[model samples]
Target: MTSRRTFLFKTLPAAGITLALARHVLAADPELAESDPDAMKLAYAADASKVDKTRNPTWATGQRCDTCELFNAPDGGDLGACSLFKGKMVRAAGWCNQYVP
Candidate 1:
């Protein structure tokens, strides 16, 4: 009979691979949190450039989600999580009225 140690050794690699793949899948497709009700109230935009200055004149240039204190983007990624969005990810270049340096 196979010992517990031997069984674990044989299955550990497979388990690790499965976990890694799952993580990658999740990281690749974060939910669109910006669409949430709270975000909508804040007038969050996926791209700061797309924000209508006419509609929101208070928004100034050079403000971006990636630079905001609430932004949570991974290195080298264009999308990241935000505290306001909860489960969704926002564009690195996105903007909103809640932006803070």
Candidate 2:
């Protein structure tokens, strides 16, 4: 029963609103900081290459969050959610004691 003009007016605004909300919801989460108490305890480094080899003998040269089993990377992006740090994102090149191949 709606006219073409009325439908356009209603649909355009609704579509725009939906797009805005979807973008907000899908926005990337904040990155985890190494200075956090939990991160410090686990020796989490934003860059795997920066991790101290002497302190963590288990760490290998190529280990990283992106390749780790605990990382939940969507679309193979550079940032992802790590099981070690809930609700925060980790860099693809990050490292932590909990990292698994």
Candidate 3:
């Protein structure tokens, strides 16, 4: 029988690899890649006046990148796959009129 320490050591690497592979597979979808272009444009256009007043009145309100569905910060908190653009990563500081939060 394997010692607890040895079992943990051996399983850790496999677990890590499995997680990495799963993330890679999820990110490889064409839909995620396709969302990048529009998201980038939205991020660039997140100015206070340009954002939808109904969704966001001030830049300090719901204009944060974390609130935008397309914002995909690599830090891995609220970031997720975007449905509008493809391949490119997004920042939490990013904002667009389409921002959900």
Candidate 4:
């Protein structure tokens, strides 16, 4: 018969540990690069400077993956995961044809 205090004490740390591990797992390293075939298919560039503004007139000078709807920045880092390229991280300053603002 564990008391409520004991239950909480045991549960809280385990829950905290699980949450920490989940974050770590979600922050795993990227599996693809801008030069990959799939990335090339989308015309993804690791640096926004490399994007052809003439072709992507809708892309503004300051637009970046960090601001894109598909990006999932990890701890607000400069490099984070993008839904466009699963299991792969993209630079915050990156751009692509698939960018949605």
Candidate 5:
């Protein structure tokens, strides 16, 4: 008969490995950018209020990439989709006073 200690020793490594792999599998996929429009809209709204001096100091001065309603992030980049324009991408580096988040 197998000893309890031996069984635990054999199973512990497997369990640890399984948990590690599960963490990797469950981690957020970097490829899933701008997958949800509603979430992105909310995010934009949240960041919009902040003044981006680097881009624009005032609402009239700066233009947010997402706020322009024409900015769209590329499929795999940190950028987001624009509501006004279609099939175009915007830069995360770009900013405007209209930025929500």
Candidate 6:
């Protein structure tokens, strides 16, 4: 019989490998472009500081993808996945109308 400890030990390596592969795949994804149709709708700015505050009154300085609640990039990653834009990557310093504090 496979003991609980034995099972955990056997699965741990595979789990680590999976995590590593996932990270690599994420890293390989292209960064979301500002001109992307969906990106245009949201007014995504690769650099949050570039957002036109005059037009986007609700926007406050310092709001960025990396700081937003939906930001899902791995720690220290400059670009990563976002829940809002499936299969696409957003810049850590980027911003959009959908930003959530």
Output the number of the lDDT-best candidate.
2
Which candidate would rank higher by lDDT, 1 or 2?
2
lDDT values of the candidates? 0.84, 0.90, 0.55, 0.84, 0.50, 0.88
Stretches > 4 Å off in candidate 5 = 30-35, 38-101
Q: Which ten residues in a row have the lowest lDDT in candidate 2?
A: 24-33
- Runs with alpha carbons beyond 4 Å of true place in candidate 2: 1-15, 18-27
Q: Please give, for residues 21-50, the per-residue lDDT of candidate 2 as tens digits.
A: 999889857889999888898899999999
- Shift of residue 24 alpha carbon in model 3, Å: 8.4
lDDT value, residue 95 of candidate 1: 87
TM-score of each: 0.71, 0.76, 0.35, 0.65, 0.34, 0.70
**Which model, 3 or 6, shows the larger TM-score?**
6
lDDT of 4 by residue, 51-81 (tens): 8888777677877888899998868988888
Q: After superposition, how far is residue 12 of candidate 4 from its true place, in Å?
A: 24
> How many residue pairs clash in all the candidates, one count each?
1, 0, 12, 0, 15, 0
Candidate 4 TM-score to native: 0.65
TM-score of 2: 0.76
Q: What is the clash count of model 2? A: 0
Using TM-score as the measure, the top candidate is 2
Tens digits of per-residue lDDT for model 3, 1-101: 99999999999999999999999988653422214566555544423335455544444554665666555655574434444445544444445556565
Q: Once all C-alphas are superposed, what RMSD does model 2 give against the true structure?
A: 3.7
lDDT of 5 by residue, 31-78 (tens): 222334733543332234464345444554344564455565555455
Ranking by lDDT: 2, 6, 4, 1, 3, 5
Per-residue CA lDDT of model 1 for 6-99, tens digit only, reads: 9999999999999999999877746565567877899988878889999888788899988899988767488888887776778899888989
Better of 1 and 6 by lDDT: 6
